[model samples]
Every structure is written in structure tokens, then in C-alpha cells.
Target: MNGILLLGGHSDIGGDLLTRLCAGRPVVLAARRAWTLTEVAERATAAGATEVHTLDFEATDLASHRALVDRAADLTGGLGTAIVAFGILGEQRRAETDEAHAVEIATVDYTAQVSMLTILADTMTRGEIIAFSSIAGWRARRANYVYGSTKAGLDAFCQGLADRLHGTPLRLITARPGFVIGSMTEGMDPAPMSVTPAEVADAVATEITDGKGSTTLWIPRRLRLLAWIMAAVPRPIWRKMPR
Candidate 1:
């Protein structure tokens, strides 16, 4: 099994996906810290990855994204499947005070994903591109609209790229999980139908195995319908509403 390459291997969703999907196959994990490599490798090995390797992957480092893709291909021997799951949750007030930090979150949430994924889409031999987007992008709330806008951009890009790869064997699975109970949004209020990283991971695994073509997976799945309603809501009505 030419295993899967997990870009944000340290994330809860990424970890769970590896545990569920990499049984009897090789798995490679990548994150911003090399220090985390060994721990991830060990967990993946224990979870049934025949081999596991890690490398440094900083979302802000766009110039190096192509190199990262090349490295994953070299390590995994043609890349069975790849999941790009990097994200950040920062305070909106702080984002106002520190424009750089807000930009960083936005870049990580959207632009970095675009950079790395474009490279992966070109380099992947025969695998799926599974990305974790967010529902916050739908109706950018005042509280976290900064992060939400970023996801909105990424969500649109993923769909367009999926269409671009239509004739090829490559599949794009864009996962949007609502109010996940996890570290990223520790102090954040839970939205309607909040879920766990495990739940998001479950949807991701199914999207890959199902061989569905270019479909976005909403954790709980029904969120797709809700997204329509959310998008339709007028800005004035949405803005006056409380977060």
C-alpha cells in the first residue's frame, strides 16, 4: 500500500483519519515542528502504518510548498492519498490589533492550502486530495469572520480545482466540520450541530473509500443543505444577529 500523506499530521482530525484509513498501509505525517515527527511516526506505526516518516511543513512558507509535495511523493512512493488539514483559530480583537497575526490565520486557513494543494494536485500519481474547510465560511459571523472568510476562499478554490481535475483519477474531498470540540477553538462557543474531530475524520475516510468524484463532505452531511440557507441569508440580517 503506497500510503497516505498527512500534511497536518499533528491535528486531531488528521490523527483520527490516519488511525482509521492507514491500517495495513504506510503513512507519512508532516507538520511545522520536526520534534513532533517521532511521536506521530510511533502512533501511525502502532495504528498499523507499515512505515511512517515526517517532515517540516509551515503553512506560511508558501515558496517551499512544491518541495514538500515532492518530498511526500518520494517518501510514500507515489502517494496513495493526501490530506491537507492545517488551520488556526485566533481572537478577533487581537486580529484587529495585530494585522500580521490575522493575515497569518487567513493564509493558513486559505492561501497556504491553495499553494500546497495546487502542487499536490499536479504531483499526485493516484490519490485523493482531502481538505478540511469550515462552515464558518458560509455566513461570516462578526466574531470570527476573519477566519471564516479564509475558509470561504479555500472552499471555492477546492471546488474549482476539483472540476479542473475532472478527467483524471484524482479526487478532491473538501470536508467542512461544524463547531468541532477541539483545541483550535478551545474558548469559542459551539455552533449548531457541533461535532468532534473523530466525527470529521469519519466523513473524510468514507469520502475517499467511496470513490465519489469531487464531492465535499459536510460532517453530519446535512450541513450541505444548511449551507444553502446560510448563504441565502441577507448580510444585514446576519450582521445584526449575535455571535
Candidate 2:
């Protein structure tokens, strides 16, 4: 089997997913601070990965994306799976007045994601590419519309990308999870039906192991029902919804 590459090597969900998928395979972890990947790399090694490597990655540097993928492929011989898991849930209040902050969120969450996914899809001939979406994108809320909007755009992009990959050897697994209670959501009140990183990892890993074709998964599965309810909520009330 070819090896696996995780773009956001330090991400909570990405780290967990790697442990689940890395057995007997060469693993590459790419992150901004390659040094920060030590713990995750150790875990992958303990989990039976044949080898673990780290590469410096800067998500906002769009020009470097393809080179990063090429380097990863060289390291692993061939990349069979790629997890595009880098993103930021920018502070909505500050983003309201800070143009730079808002753009940072957009670039990281949406634009950078698009850049990496496209590179992976075009370069890798087969295997899986994992992208993350969120229920916040189901409908933007006033509290976190900036972040929500990014997810909304990303979810739509993933939908189209899935279709484009249909019948091809490459498959995209877009995970639209609800509130994730992790380092990202730290200090915020956990939303109803919140899920943990391990839970999200389990869901995606299961799909990679047992599923076929491009698929979109609602983590916890029942979130699909809630996502439908989210849409039916009137705009007036929806605008009042919490992040």
C-alpha cells in the first residue's frame, strides 16, 4: 500500500485519523511548525506506521502547495491518502471590524483548502482525499458568519469536486461535522450534539476503510437531521442562533 500524507499534522482530528490509518505505511505530517509534530509523529510510530516524517507547511502560501505535495509523494514513494485538515475558526467579534483577521480566516479555511485539494486531486492518481466542512455552514449565523461563510463555500466546492471525481480512482470524503469540542472550540460553551476529535476521526477512518466512491459524511450521522432542521429555521430566528 502507498503511504499517507496529513497536511495539517498538528490538527487534533488529523492526528487521531492518522493513528487509525497509518499502520504499516510511511506517514508524512506537514504543518507550519514542523517541530510541533513530534508528539503526533511519536503516536503514529507507536501505532505501527512503518515510518513517520514531518515537513514544513504554510497553508496561506498557495504557490508552495504543489511542491509540498510532490515532496510528500517522494517521501512516501506514493501517497495513497491525503487529509486536508488545516483551518481556523476566527473570532467572529474581532473579525467584524478587523479586515485582515477576516481575510486570514477566509484564506486559511476556504482559499487554502481549495488550493490544496485541487493540487491533490490533480496530482494523485488514486486513493482518498479528505476535506472537512461544518454544520455552521448549513446556514450562516450572525455570531460566526465569517467562519460559517468559509465553510459554506468549502462545502459547496467539495460537492462539485466530488462530482468531478466521480468514476475516477480518486475519492473525496467531505466531513460536515457539528460543533467540535477541541482546542479550536476551547472556552466556548459546547453546543448541543457536540463531538470530540476522536469521534470525528473514527467516523472518517471507518468510511475510508469500508466506504466506496466519493462520500460526504455527517459525523455522528444524526447531524444530517439537525442540518435539515437548521435550514428550515426562519432567517429572523436563524440570525439569532449561537455559534
Candidate 3:
């Protein structure tokens, strides 16, 4: 089997997913600061990875994305799986007044994801590409619309990309998880039906191992019902919903 590449080396969910998928394979972890990948690399090694490597990555550096993928492919021989796991949950309140902050969220969470996914789809002849969407995207709330809007756009992109890859050897597993309670949401109150990084990883990893074709998964599965309910919520009330 070809090796695996994780775009966000330091991401909690990405690290967990790598531990699940890295057995006997060469693994590449790419992050903004390669040094921060040490713990994740060690875990991958303990999990039976034949080799573990790290590369410097910058999600906002669009010009460098293709080069990073090429470098990863060079390290792994050819990538059989790539997890697009880099994103930011920018400060919603600050973003309301700071255009730069809002754009930063847009660039990292949506534009960068699109750039990377397109490159991976075009370059890799087969295997899987994993992308993250969220319940925040299912219906935008006033509290976090800036962040939510990006996820909304990303979810739509993934839907189209999954269809484009239909009947192909390459498959996209778009994971739509709800309220992940992790380092990202350190001080925030946990939302109803909140899940952890491990849970998200497990759901996606199981699908990667056992599923066929490109599929969009509502992590926890029941989130689909919540998503339906979310859609039917009137805008006035939906705008009042908490993040």
C-alpha cells in the first residue's frame, strides 16, 4: 500500500486518525511548524508506521500548496491517503469588526481547503482524500457566522467534488462533525451533542477502512436528523441559536 499524508500534522483529530491509519505505512505529517509534530510522529511510530516524516506547511500560502503535496508524495513514494485537516475557529466577536480576521478564517477554512483538495484530486490517481465540514455549516448562527460561512462553502465544495470523483479510483470522505470539544474550543461551553476529537477521528477512520466510493458522513450518524431539524428552524430563531 502507498503511504498516508496528513496536511495538518498537529491537529488533534488528524493525529488520532493517523494513529488509526498509519500501520505499516510511511507517514507524512505537514504542519505550520514542523517541530510541533514530534508527539504526533512518535504516536504514529508506536502505532506501527514503517516511517514517520514531517514537513513545514502553511495553509494561507496558496502558492506553496502544490509544492508541499509534491514534497509529501516524494517522501511517501505516492500518497494513498491525504487528510486535509488544517483549519481555524477564529474569534467570532473579533471577526465581526476585523475584516482581516474574517478573511483569515475564510482563507484557511475554505479557500485553502479548496486549493488543496483540487490539487490532491488532480494529482493522485487513486485512494482517499479526507476533508472536514461541520454542523456549524449546516445552518449559520449569528454567534459564529464568519466561521460557519466558511464551513458552509466547504461543505458545498466537498459535495460537488465527491460527485466529480464518482466512478473514479480516487474517493473523498467528507466528514461533517458537530461541535468538536477539543483544544480549539478550550474555554467554550460544550454544545448539546458535542463530540471529541477521538470520536471524530474514529468515525472517519472507520469509513476510510470499511467504506466504498466517495461518501459524506455525518459523524455520529444521528447528526443527520439534527441537521434536518436545523434546516427547518426559522431564520429568526436560528439566528439566536448558540455556537
Best by lDDT: 2
lDDT of 1 at 221: 75
Clashes (N, CA, C under 3 Å) per candidate: 0, 0, 0
Work out the TM-score per prediction.
0.93, 0.98, 0.98
Residue range 1-243, candidate 1, lDDT tens digits: 266888887788888888888878877788988576777678788888888878888878899988887787787777878888877876778997899989888888888999988988888757688888888877788877888889889989988988887787776778888889888768878778889988988878876777455377777778778879877889888887655
Relative to the unseen true structure, what is the C-alpha lDDT of residue 84 in candidate 2, on a scale of 0 to 100? 92
Query: Where in model 1 is the C-alpha error above 4 Å?
Result: none
RMSD of each: 1.7, 1.0, 1.0
lDDT of 2 by residue, 1-243 (tens): 388999998799999999999989999999999998889999999999999989999999999999999999999999999999999888899999999999999999999999999999999999999999999998999999999999999999999999999898888999988899999998999888899999999999999888654389998789889889888999888878777
Please give the range of 10 consecutive residues that has the lowest summed lDDT in model 3.
Answer: 205-214
Candidate 2, backbone clash total:
0
Q: How many clashing residue pairs are found in candidate 1?
A: 0
- Candidate 1: give its CA RMSD in angstroms: 1.7
What lDDT does the true structure give each of the candidates?
Answer: 0.81, 0.92, 0.91
